[model samples]
Target: MSSYYGRPVLKEPVWKVPDVPAYLYLGGMAGASSSMALLAGLTGRQRLARTGRLAAAVGATASVGALVHDLGRPMRFLNMLRVVKLTSPLSVGSWILAPFSGLAGAAAASDVTGLLPVPGRAAGVVAGVLAPAMTTYTAVLLADTAVPGWHEAYRELPFVFAGSAVASAGAVGMVSAPAESAPARRMAVSGSVLELAASRRMEGRLGLAAEAYRTGRAGMVLRAARAATAVGAGLALLAGRSRAAGIAAGACLTLGSIATRYGVFEAGRETARDPRYVVDPQRERLRERESAGRGEVH
Candidate 1:
């Protein structure tokens, strides 16, 4: 039999991006802001803590709203609550988000009321722990999809997001906190460093998918991220940091982080749409299957 050129391509889900991108942005902000609130409370920045908590609460609410609104049938969103499928990353994520969101709301509310009970301290601490995980886990959730760029870059995605979340939250803190606070500077610096490292790791570890991060719009966003992270962190480390510098850097990091997410997701859509990613891998599998079949027959 003769083989034909220009074979037909297979496709994955065709998602309307408006909601997913917004959801990703909101979720990251919410998680990061919550982390900031917890840290501010610990460091005795009452005003910062109070403002940060309100910020987190609003962000979190927006996130949940975005999530449901993204679903065409918003009413059916409640169906997700009834299931527990460990193998499904979205399912696992929904579970993780439920309690985390509740706790974040409680913490934010306590800050507003000026009655953060000693017992509630335990809740805030727990929420603080869950906050980072909430941000990190979304990377895992995106990667779990049968999307090439996302699935292949799995190992580095969580770290990338973690660093981005920190930077994003730190930026918000910079807006709210006084410039001289050592903790805020440290957090921003830490986030910037981690984000830069994680981006490098993504470029290094993922050979093909890394191309997504390196070219066109993706490249532009990543390039900006690198520059911002490096410069921001460097300035913070040197001369003991300044509010203006920190704000600028944080803005860059926040923007860069958001762009990265969109770029990654877009690349995955491209990967899923392209015949090469699906065909080549499947062809290899078929060859193996044929060889095994022949061997069994013999």
Candidate 2:
């Protein structure tokens, strides 16, 4: 509304409501759970492994449904499979999602169906191999967009997303598994710390474009995310003493992780809605380049 005319440089994301954010959270949880399942299986923690596998499968399934729903039609998603687009983040992400889902499903099936041992182990390994990509490619997808906050914060987004994913998956494990599995508690605490730190660093580094994170609705949501993460992680550290505490910690962590996803999404949307965020950064970049050029001439 100021002198810049209030027109956004980038179109606002058409992906609305629960679909996009839900996909982000579910995909993250699925990826982390798949990794946990593989590690637990290798380490002979059968109960933890089974829980992780089932969680991974369910998360992956729901994530796929969310993606399809977001696409507006099932046919569009099918059409996406017609080509392997190396340059398109969504295309590559779609491919990565497929095998990871299948592998996770097979691993989960082996647990409930008792359908042999070797295939389940093999699927677990394959899913684990793809888990990191599954968790991180969405960061690249969002960063590739023209949105100012997302593109500017690209360096830190992957770490933030990864940490959130680990926290969410660990929350699932803590809720479903016995307290004996210390890895779940450790992962929740460590991941929460990492998520909080990375988000702070990202907000700090974005300069003027980070206004969305400092003010308005975006700021409020992000502050809540920070509070939830801190309390959840802190409680998780002391949760070992009591089962009720463990459940509470798990619930808090899961809520925090979901809040983190929605907060980041909203911040980027706010940045896209306001022209100043987009214009100011570009103007600054141009000014810096001009200054360097003048110095070179001198």
Candidate 3:
């Protein structure tokens, strides 16, 4: 089979834009929020804890809805549970998300209703343990795929996603919780720094494969996202003094997080459409194998 630069050798992702990325964004937000909730609750910051719990519950539930909508059939989503596929990230994610939604929801309800404190705390602990995994599993999911952009960039995807998740959760808390949320502000700044640095390093390492991040539609979106992240982090640093600044920081961080997801999704699509990305890597591996064989013979 002849592979052309413009033609796709692999099946293009069936996932539509905004939807799949939105699912990723929401899931990260949910997971991070759950973590924030646990920390706040343990620290006795009642208001911040309440906000985090609500965000966790709402984000997780809504993300499930988005995933189901993307699947196009609720029954199809159900069918996924007929058996366990250890190698399938989607399957693993489904199991994680299902229990997480319940735990987060129950915790949120307990907080809202002023009842079941013990169970709520227990659930929050469990959810917190699962939160980082939930935030990061999607990165592994994308990297395990055949898409050159995702697979080749595996080294950085988890950290990038985790940072994005932290920023997203912090942004939500900064906007909704009281001005005393120092942890939220710090999280926004720190996570943005981590995300931007990791992404830049990933692109630097990609060589020609980095084309997915540097040119075309994905590049444009990522550029905007990078700007938003930097500006947001700056605003978050200044947020200690000004309420308005905090709001602006929160808004920018949220936008940056969403843009990051969309940019990543577009980059994967671009990578899949380019034949050179797939071919060159395989060719190099083949050359290495040939060299090894000759060395063995000698």
| Pairs that collide, model 2 | none
Stretches of candidate 1 off by over 4 Å are 1-12, 115-122, 235-241, 281-298
Error of 1 at 248 (Å): 1.9
Superposition TM-score, candidate 3 onto the true structure: 0.95
lDDT by residue (54-133, candidate 3, tens digit) is: 99999998888998898999898788777778889979877888889899999999888879988987887898889998
Sort by lDDT, best first: what order? 3, 2, 1
Which candidate gets the maximum TM-score versus the true structure? 2
Looking at model 2, report the run of 10 residues with the lowest lDDT sum: 1-10
Residues 113-198, model 1: lDDT tens digits:
66766645666677777788777888998777777778877888888878777766766666566543455557667877787787
Worst lDDT 10-window in candidate 3? 1-10
lDDT by residue for model 2 (1-298), tens: 3434656667889988689999999999999998988888788888888888998999999998999999989898888888999999989998998889999999899888988678887988899889999888888899999998899999999999999999888888888886455888888999999999999899999898788887887788788888888888887887778778778888888888888888889989998888788777778889999999999999
Query: What is the overall TM-score of model 1 with all chains considered together?
Result: 0.83
After aligning candidate 2 to the native by TM-score, how far in Å is the CA of 277 from where it should be? 1.2
For candidate 1, the 10 contiguous residues with the lowest summed lDDT are 1-10
Pick by lDDT: 1 or 3, better one: 3
